[model samples]
Target: MSDLRTRPTTKRPPTGDLAAEGRRRRASIAAFYTVLIVVAIIYIYPFVIQAGTSFKTDGDSTYNPLNPFPSLFTLDAYATLADVDFPLWFRNSVIVTAFVTVGRVLLCSAAGYALSRLHFVGRKFLLAAILAVMAVPGVVLLIPKFLILNQLGMYNTFSAMIIPLLWDATGIFIMKQYFDTIPPAVEEAARIDGAGVVRRFWSIMLPMAGPALVTLTVFAFQGSWNEFTHFIVARSSAETNTLTTGVAALTTGQFGSGNRYPLKLAAALIMTIPVALVYFVFQRKLVRGQGGGAVKG
Candidate 1:
């Protein structure tokens, strides 16, 4: 007869120096967190100051420039913003950003899919040209964009501001890289079932590109929202003024005079809200999106 239960084995005590190892590991962890906290403070301090300054009086902001607290807490800055054409500038910015984001996403995705799947003449050359455009400095295009906008009668118009930004080389590059990672057989199966190129792309391929699309959407939104350089050259009318251009004018005393730190900071603070919300919402997906184009094989 066999014993039903096995004998319990004696557990050995841990060998020497484990306590020392544990203390060292704890110390290392402490040091790592200490550095992280310091860096976070460094990055976050300015934003805190920005928010605080928005509530400050101009005199407080200037005399105690580094002070984050208001000498006299007030809503005058925000009140001033409310009285002015700030809402108009905000609306114009929203309009341009909406158009640019949606247009860039659709156009860039289509261009990327075509470059990835369709075998057409000059495709490689076109991709190379896009790369070359990316290589070209943005400052170099300012004058040309202005001139072309003027010639095309799109100057001082929303079309001028958004059309130029709707399809950038970066978006195309991102989409193409992501699409390259997708297996060809997926599209081929769609084709075998009587799906056409447009149908397959719109129905299957575009939807499969969720990560890239999210990345593109966020990028487009932020870029268009924060765009200053192009807006400067694209339009001169106050009616077409976006937040970036409008804020610049406000800073230069076009709207108001004298330091106006609180007012300026208030505008900046408001401008930051939309981009921050978008980034926070899609941040996790933004991280995952980077992996779409990172295929090893």
Candidate 2:
């Protein structure tokens, strides 16, 4: 017992060294937090400035571009927006976005389900065509889209705006991938119960796709809401101006001559609210949708 006890207690680490190691660990943690905070501030600073500048006067915004706080706060920008066709633009955007979202969800899901489950003559070729379409840059299609709308006499109408955005290749691809992850047994069991293709898909499969549906809805809403170029080419009437085009006109001196930075910023801020709310509300579902395919029974 004495020999065991006298074995120098495994030469315990020096108290000073332990204290220094703890200090080093704490310093590393503090440094990591400092870097994260700095990066967050860097990324968030512009939005903070934009919000503050929206409340500033024209002179204040012009002179104090970098400063977020306004020396003379005013509601002049929002007041000015009130006089413009802002409400009309907002209404147009809401109508277009609603129809586009619903159409995309239904159509993309149907196409995805067909691609995933149904075997057809040109299924492989059709999927390949869709992939090719996805590869093509959107800007390259602007002229073609415009020409098609003009040919169909859809120009300067809500149909032009809403119909063109109804089907998204990416959304279809996402749904197809998600459906592929589901077990065939689920659908087969429904078929054994005398369910038809439409009934099985609508009742048995669609409900299980909640995460993917939410994700698709969010994308469709945000894409249609913020879409600018398509709306630009699809319609030209002020009566059908979406928030993007209308706000863009504001920035280009559509309302007045001078810089109106505050008005522009306020319009941008207001336009961003719906998208932000959507992301916050459905963020969890979006994450789940992305990872759902990886989960197995």
Candidate 3:
């Protein structure tokens, strides 16, 4: 009885089979990692080459198109950028991105809360309209946007550049989705305590949306910072040029052309830094927001 109790109820898999299965699992994992590494390299190689080319001389970059390591490193490109209005462009981008981000976060959160919680006539219709707007191609609206800005007499001003982007369909959609996931019980308790609608949203609910807020902020900053086409249509002066337009002008030989690859690459590299930093800092929060729980118990 004791021996039977100590023994296996059924025969276990043979040692050879277990070994073979283990080997197969290891091989599968190895293959997965190999593919992942290859894909990462493919995605990252362009940025690596861009950084390398920025440090190379113009002749070196033109000659060594495939090589990431500079044959003759130089800082002439950076110096050239300094002589231009690069600092001014950087300042303009910073100012525009900051204001746009703040406005989008505040306005989108308010709109999202109203759409998700408040009952009003045409609420569903308004959401449907927002969805429809999201589906429309942004390029199709460029002419209309330009016309509106011109009619408003906001053309060639920072207002034209920043105001149109202050509230976006995507931000509202994201916030609404997040708000919907919040349990109604929490808001009900706040209401029972005599909290007003705005008080409940601001002091109770918005505080719980930290991850979603961070995600929205990241997207807003990136979009506004990289905005080029709208800026082009909105403003026509060199003073209003952001990094995107300024760098583009450098690439197109506004200064002078003969393959000034280094200058262009340097400008591109500088412009990418802020977005990259923001992404890295809030990447974990963004992931949490996507997983649908900003306020985890």
Candidate 4:
């Protein structure tokens, strides 16, 4: 009885089932990476071809559309595009994107904060209206937006491009959801210190909302920078053309003197640079925002 505490039992050997389970898990992981690698190659190969083709001659592009290496690399396409409206198009895109991104971020955040935190008479109804607007298809609004812009006499102007898109329903929704997730205790502390609504939002809330704000900035910048349809309906003059419209014109035999594939590809590659940069820079935030917002929704 005294030595019973020191007694030991026989240990069991490893089971076949455990070994089988480990093998199955390893196989599943290997299959997942195999599929992932294939998918990544499929998505990335087109860009590789386009980038390579941009450096090739027109004859080389036609002959070797699938080739990622050119028989003879030429800078003529880029050199030629540099001599045309590329600079103007780039400038216009920068101006429009800057204005629209700034406007959308500020306006959407303001609207969202008010909608989420403020207690107004029609807050519920207004929130519902914003949700409804978000559901409306953007492509269907092409004509209506054009008519309203035309009637307001904003057509063919920068105002035409910027005004209608100054605020978006979807952006407002994202901001509202993010704001709602913020802990009320922090806000309460601010209010207890006798800070007003504006001060609380500016000094307390916004600073704490760095992640959401960065996410919104990325979306606004990308959306406005790549905007195509709104520009088409809002302005018609070459002087007002954005990169999207100008490059589109290039593709449809509207400029460049011939079916200039290399020139157009070069232009596309250039236009893609900003978006690619933004995507890579904020990819982590983008994934986080997506997951957080999905949870809230």
Highest-scoring model, TM-score: 3
Candidate 3 Cα misplacement greater than 4 A, ranges: 1-8, 290-297
Across 187-217, the per-residue lDDT of candidate 2 in tens digits comes to: 8887887888898788877877778889899
Q: Enumerate clash totals for all models, in the order shown.
A: 0, 0, 0, 0
Q: What local lDDT does model 2 show for residue 235?
A: 88
Residue pair clashes in candidate 1: none
Question: Local distance difference test, per candidate?
Answer: 0.89, 0.89, 0.89, 0.86
| Candidate 4 residue 223 C-alpha distance from true site, Å | 0.8
Better of 1 and 4 by TM-score: 1
CA lDDT, candidate 1, residue 203: 80
Model 4, poorest ten-residue lDDT window? 288-297
The list of candidate 1 runs beyond 4 A from truth reads 1-16, 254-257, 290-297
Query: In model 4, which runs have C-alpha deviations exceeding 4 angstroms?
Result: 1-26, 254-259, 288-297
How far residue 257's Cα lies from its native spot in candidate 1, in Å, is 4.4
Query: Which of the two candidates, 3 or 4, achieves a greater lDDT against the reference?
Result: 3
Q: Which residue pairs of candidate 2 clash?
A: none
> TM-score for each prediction?
0.91, 0.89, 0.92, 0.88
For residue 22, model 2's alpha carbon misses the true position, in angstroms, by 4.2
In candidate 4 the C-alpha lDDT for residue 142 amounts to 99
